[model samples]
Target: MNKTTVPSAPYTRRPPSPPQLPYPIFLNQPRRAGSRAEFVLTPSYDNVDPGQLTAEDLAIITQNQPQLVAPNVSGDWRYEQRREAQRILEFLYIGPHAVIRDHDFLRREGITMIVVARDSRLANRSMASVDRAGGTLGVRCQYIDVEGPRDLIHGFPQTIRDINDHLLSVYRGQMQEMDKNDRLLRKSDPPVRGKVLVTCESGNELAPAIVAAYIMSVFGKDMQSALQFVGLQRFCACFDENTKRLLQSWQDILRARASVARARTPVPGRPVPEAKPKRRLDQLRDHNDDEMGLGECTMDRERFLGRDAFVPFVDITNDNAS
Candidate 1:
């Protein structure tokens, strides 16, 4: 009695029991496999383009499918491009930091910009030679000193804007022309001479992440697909688990933002229906014009009273009991 009997440890099975197969974890997944898969943006996000994809006709290539874009590209030229910088998108490339100095290769690809995503504090120091290299091409170079995961995530918006503005500079010029010449129409497609080269110290960790972010933003792809899209093209590019987690967080942020936008958009008939309650109230007041009236003014009668209106659920249990 003096020695309290310790509760026996819960009986443990040698092996954990397997879950029943009746219930599956996943449900209603979207189709991924196809030649020309279509993705629709939320109704609010697509004021201009219904969807988005980086096009080769504008200036594109597949990561694994090298022959997809320029079938006639000579192997010798391909080796030159692959030796230092590699093409990941129609207007985008990624490689090691040293590639910036390879001006001849840059000239060959017509690279208008070089985006350096540096991971070290020394990254803040400007590579002026690269700027001169870019100056010759008549464009400015971008150096983003994003060291850790947190800084990289925060820098996504500004980085994307810079890349997009540079890539579509010609399109913007064409739009300005259209604005100037209101009476007459012009050509359909403008020549896209602008191209980008993304680089990191090793061209493995951070650079790939940035390229993946660009793909995800422009193509509406998830984090995994975006990375895969890049990895196929740049085989040297590394995608560690931590980086995957980082991009998944970015994916979540984008999804939440899209949801908020869709939520804010008013339904097609909502505005017209909102006035229905007010109109109904006015009609009732007119019908009672000859009878005893509430003496409500025109403004009061015209006002819709549905703001913060709460209609409680009626309890049906008593009816069944009776």
Candidate 2:
């Protein structure tokens, strides 16, 4: 027994294995209300290891969690290239960004006016760009600021009217200047004398509604037709159902106003009679004029020639007298 005890291993206990962690150690931890922490402890028994998740998988899982998502920024941040209308010449443009972002493109396209369909704050920013560009571009930039969607709907009729009036006034001023300078006018019917960019935060709903309303106002198209025409120009142009109804209501109002205007407007090619009672010719005549000279020449012929001077007369004996 003493011989066999030569190399008996010293009595030793194997080191204890690390304790296995619960599938997700934080599963039972309480989450704070409204916490924006990205990681959420979700328990699963499918034998999938948390360490096995790829970055993309983790990202997708995190994205699925509502608390960690970010809010959307305004549409102004999503700038895009200026798009011209297909039905109209570059007279009208639609865009998501401010005109200042595309100053060069505007200069190249001869955009003289910028109709910014945004709130005051956003419009002010765009207006600053317009002012900066105006100094170098040698052109005046006009801006139109429309209130947000609700206000726009409430004031749609007046808003569109005001915009049309501004456009007409600017275009007329340009035409007058051109005429004064003896410049050749652009030959397009519904002349593209003024280039206006109608824009909103995203150039999505409000801008399109305004543009469509403009089309309906200027081009005499129905709301549906106007929207379709705008859609043709910019495929993304659209309006919600409420906006469509507002537009339709506006169209009705416009039609009513137009009818009233036509009724009030005197017919062309015929002069309107004066509303005041007419005065007699004698009452209108100036009595002092008769004293000066009434239907008679006032020249003094006697002073030019003596009273005895005789005028030459044709005679039958002229042939013999010569």
lDDT of 1 by residue, 1-322 (tens): 1232322345454887654222111122243564322222221122112123234412322222322221112212343444476777667888888888777888788887788887668675777667777677665688888767557888887897788777666444444343554743434453445688888888877888888887666555677666655665665566766677778888877777655554555678776223234456545455465355544453365466657654433345544678
How well does candidate 2 score on lDDT at residue 67?
29
The models' CA-based lDDT, in order, is 0.61, 0.52
Task: Please give, for residues 1-322, the per-residue lDDT of candidate 2 as tens digits.
Answer: 2432332334445985544322111213333575422222232212222223333443332233322111111222222423432222235667664545666777777766555566755554645565676787655555556555655756555555555454555454534335556884644544445466666666777777877776555444566655555554455555666677777776786566555554555788978655678797556556665577641332334376657655333343554567
User: Runs in model 1 with CA error above 4 Å?
Assistant: 1-83, 174-189, 270-322
Q: What lDDT, from 0 to 1, does candidate 2 have?
A: 0.52
What C-alpha RMSD separates each model from the true structure?
Answer: 14.7, 43.0
Candidate 2, after superposition: displacement of residue 278 in Å?
34
Candidate 2, residue 296: lDDT? 30
